[model samples]
Target: MSTNARQQLQHHLRNARYEVLPLRGTLEQVQGLPPGTTVTVTSSPSKGTEATLDLAARLRGSGMHVVPHLAARLVRDSAHLDELLSRIEALGLTEVFVIAGDADNPAGRFTDALSLLRGMEEIGNRPHRVGITGYPEPHSFISDQMTIQATDEKARYADYIVSQICYDPNTIASWVKTMRARGVTLPVYIGAPGSIDPSKLLRISMKIGLGQSMRFLRKQHGVVGKLLTRYTPENLFDELSPYLVNPDYNIAGCHLFTFNEIAKTRQWAMETADRLQEVPA
Candidate 1:
C-alpha cells in the first residue's frame, strides 16, 4: 500500500479496541495494550454482566478506556439500569456498548438495545458515548429489511456501530454502502475476528447462528476444508484498507474479537502498530 493509505489506516488503528471475553487473565493480557487503547469487555450469558463490570472497573483503574457491553436482556428493570449506570459513573467510565444480549429470554422490560438506550436516556444516565451492534452479513434470525430498519432506528441513539464478525471485505464494503444509503450514518467500527484458532472460531460462529458467514468462509477455501483452522485479520484489513482510508465512509476503526487469546493477539497488534508507525505519512 502507498504510504498515505497506510498512514490513513493507522489513524483508525490508533483508536481501535481489543475486544476480549471477561474471563481469567483478561486484565493481564489487556495490559499489553498501549495507554489510550480502548478495551471492550464482552457480556457472557453464562457469567452475566457482573464479570464485565468487574473487568471494566479493573481496566479503568489501570488507566485503559474501558467499554463494557451492557446486555439489555440481562438487566431486570429501570432501577437495575440506574444502578449499573451509577456504578459505571463512579468509576468515571463515559462509554458503553449496548446489545440485545445472547439470552433466549428477556430478563425484564428491555428486550433490545434500542429499548435500553431509551431507558438510559429517560433515566438521565446516558453515557458520554454509546455503541450499538450492526451486522454486515444478513442476520440468521432476522430479515435483512428488519435489520436495516432496526439499525436505522438505533442510529438515532447510538454514537457508533461495532459490526458483528464479518470475513468478506466486499460484503462489508457493500453493507457500509447500504447503511450510508439508508442514512444509518453512525461512525462504524468494523468488527474482525482476532487471531484465533479457526476451529474454535467456527464453533463460536456456528453457536451464534452465523451459518451464512461460516458458509462464506467455507466457500473461500473451496468446499468445507480445514483452511480455516487458523485465521488472522491481516488479509481482512488489507481488503478493507480502501474503505478504511476513505474519509467519506466515516469508518472509525476496528473492534477485534480476540476470544481471550490475548497474548498472540497482542503480539499481532504490536507488530501492526509498529508497521503503522514506520510508514511515512
Candidate 2:
C-alpha cells in the first residue's frame, strides 16, 4: 500500500471503516456496537429490497452510520424503487451500496444495476454517497467489457465504488489501475476479507456469490487455499499499504467483508490501529 493509502486506512480505523454485513442476524449485533462504528447492510434477491429499509432503521436507531445495500436485482419496478427511497429518507440513511445481487436469474423487473440507478434518478432521490461494485478478477458470468461498461455507467450515478474482495493484492492493484486507465473516476473502497477463519471465509464466500472466489480457490488446486486456512487479511493489507499512501490513485479506504463476525472483526481493526500507531513515526 502507498503511504497515502496507509494514512487513509489509519483515518478509517479511527472511525471504524468496516462494511458489508450480509451474514445472517449480524444487523442486530452490529447495530448495538459502540459509537463511531460503520456497518454496511446487503440486500439479496431472496430477501428483497425491504431488508435494506428494515435493517437501516434498526441500525440508525442504535446511533451508527448505517449503509444499506440497495440490490438492483431484487426491485420489482420503478414504483418499488420509489418506496425504497422513501423508506431510506424516513430512516435518514445517506449512503447506499448498489450492486447486481446474486440471483440465479433476474428476480423481478430488474436484472442489473443500471436500471436501479436510472430509477433512483427518475424518483429524484440522491443519497450523499452511492457506491457500486468492481470486479478485480474476471466475473464468472460477466465479460471484462461488460464489467467495465457497467462500472463506467454506474460511475455517472455513483459517488464511489467498493470492489469485490480479492485475495491477491497484486490483482486488486492492477484492477484499480485498469479502471483509472479506462476513465472510471469514482473513488474506490477496496474490499478485503476480515479476520475470519479461512474455512469459514471460503464457505461464506461460496454462500454469498463465489463469482470468482470459487474459481480462484479451485484453480489453486489446494496449496494456496490450505495456507489460507490460517490466513487473514494481513498479507492483503501489506499489498495495499503502499496504495493507501498515494492520492493520485484515489484509493479512499477499506470495505471489510466481515461475513458477520463483527465482534472479532472490530477487535482486529482496533488492534491493528493500535499497532499502526505504535510503529515508528
Clashes of each: 0, 14
Off by over 4 Å in 2: 1-6, 20-28, 205-222
- Sequence-dependent TM-score of model 2: 0.89
TM-score of predicted structure 1: 0.93
**Candidate 1 Cα errors over 4 Å, as ranges:** 276-281
Across 1-281, the per-residue lDDT of candidate 1 in tens digits comes to 76766776666565668898888888998887877778899896798999999999999988999998999999999999999999998988999999999899989999988899899989998899999999988888889898888899888988999989877888889999988987777889989877788778878777667766667778887544375664678778878887877766789888888898876776776678688788666
lDDT of 2 by residue, 27-106 (tens): 66685468656788877766666766677777788888888888877777888778877778778888887887777677
Worst 10 residues of 2 by lDDT: 207-216
